[model samples]
Target: MNWRLVFVLFAVFAVGTNALIMAGIVPAIATGLNTSEAIAGLGLTVFALTYAVVGPTLPIILSRFGRRTIMAGGLILFIGGTVLSGLAPDVSIFMLSRVIVGVAAAAIPPQAAAIAIAISPPGREGRALGLLSAGILLSIALGVPLGSLLGIWLGYSGAFLFLASLGIVGLIGLFFIPPTPKPAKATIAEQFAPFRRPAVLVLGLCAFLFAWCQYSITTFFAPLVKDSAGISDVEVPILLVIYGLTGVVAALFGGRLIDRFSGYAVAIGGFIAITITTPLFSVASSFLIAAIVVVVWSLAQNVTFPAAQVEMGRLHPANPATAFALFAALVQAGGAIGAAVSAGVLEALGPRWIAPVAAVATLIGTIVISLLARRLRRQNEAQSILVEATVDEAS
Candidate 1:
């Protein structure tokens, strides 16, 4: 195993945690900032929104720099943002800090994906990507609960300071990482070419729609679970643990699924499963039932990511990092919209309707993408047969 790559992944995992787990401590943040919970939630909403917009642009702006240069610069921005956010005296400044983090947040997945794919081989792409995805799941598993605990113990500001400190640790770990050899270079327009491929376009659309549905409900999973199951506030962290742990297992298993069946299938099928379960989540009467459903949903969600990534690796086999980066960028784009909509859903229908509504959207997107996948598969098979026939004729 490549230790440098491992370090890169560890850094990525830690950074992803920083972006994602802040919401878990939002209540604590509200208290610290002397603001309403609603206001604190906006911090997340704003970061995601800015991250989405910047995700695409950042790669382009930083193209002149080496991947190592970009990654290091990005980490510095993340640590700076975290520190500023930690010290902010008011809610507005706190949000501004989050935006700084968002700028750095866009820089992470590309380097992480590049590192993961760089260290692996062709046939094992799915497995490698799966393990990388595992880092993401692991962070969720560990980061949120730990953050919540820190918030409760030392206050939200202290918790954020710790998070910033984690960013610095990741940066140091990343410094020990060896720089990846540059792949074939592309102009901005060339980098954007994948945007026009039918398969890529379809997947991008599917991602956005899927995000809209999934994020709407997931943003409020803790509260939803608590309310649905009548669980005490203490149980939220434990249940979140359940949710995160199951996702880790899913990452391990989902990689095999991708390696065997192809990433396209895993991507489409996972979303379908999520769509099917959305109703259950929306209406589960018992905490245990909701927990079970959330676990399944989280598992399925974990699979779709690596599956899509493995596909991206194969799809743009010539420029794997760029492919993965574009996929990561699209995820943020969809997430931005999804997160924004979730706030509206939370306010309008009391969270009961969000999952089902998202389910319907996922179902719709799945149908279109599944059809496209079939068409792509058939085209590939037909081309294979033609090559074989030509070889036979030559013999």
Candidate 2:
């Protein structure tokens, strides 16, 4: 294992922890800020919206800078924003802090994945990408739960502070990694060239849809679990850990599967699994049953990330950072929409509707992506046959 990559993974973990910690601590935030849980949950929506808006553009604007500068700058801003979130006296300020953090976060993960792909050994891209994706899962598994405990003990503000401290560690670690040279400047048209490909377009849609499905349920997970399983705030983290741990395993294993099989196949399998398992949340009447459903859903959901990332890298080999930034933006956009939509559903229809709605979204995404993948495969096969026929005729 390259120790440098480990630091990159750690950096991703810090960003992801901040991004997701709110899911575990939303009720505390609601109470502390004198707002409804639905309103407080908009903190995440704010972050995702900001990220979706900024993620694609900022990285391209900063394309001339080296990865080290971009990563370090992002961390500095992230730390500042997180600190603000911890210190904010009102919900407005807290939401503003999330915007700042989201902007900063926009620059990190896609760059981190690009760095990983750049530095990884040949034929191991899937594993490298998987390792980084696992950082997000690890944050869910460990960081969110631990943050929840801190929220229970100290306050929601304290949880934000703890996340800030992690960002500082990632900042220091960045200094030790080898410096990456800046790429030559390119025109805006060149930067957006990947969008011209049909495959990239379909994949972006898949990214958006899957993220929509996943976050719709997860952004409000604390309340959903409580409503469905009679679980308390303290117990929410335990189920999150189970979900996260299962995701971690799936991410690592999915990476190898992508390496051996096809990213398209692995991604489609993941989507199918999610579609099948997510609706089961409606029927989970006991903790054991809920946990079982969580484990299966986590396994299915986590695998899609690495597989999509690997496909993105392969599709835009010359400018992978651009592809990754686009994918990240779409994912955030979907998450923002999902969170906002689900909040309305929770307020009106109740938590029972969240799972079924999520499942429907995933099912739609699965069908669209599956059709596109099949077409792409057939095109490739046809091209191969044409080339072979020409060669045989010449011989």
User: Which is the leading candidate under TM-score?
Assistant: 2
State the lDDT of candidate 1 residue by residue for 85-131, as single tens digits.
87899988998998998878778777667666666665666777777
Minimum summed lDDT over a 10-residue window in model 2 is located at: 176-185
lDDT value, residue 363 of candidate 2: 93
Reference-based TM-score, model 1: 0.87
lDDT to native, each model: 0.75, 0.85
Candidate 2 accuracy as lDDT: 0.85
Per-residue CA lDDT of model 2 for 1-395, tens digit only, reads 56788888878988888877787689988888888999989898789789888888886788888888888899999999999988888899999999999999999997788788777777778888888988888987887667677888878888888878888888888877777656546788887888888889889999989999988988888778778888776677778789898998988887888888888898999999999998888778878889999999998888888898788778877667778989999997888788889999999999988888888888988998899889989999999999999999999
Off by over 4 Å in 1: 1-3, 27-40, 89-93, 226-230, 339-350, 386-395
Looking at model 1, the pairs that clash are none
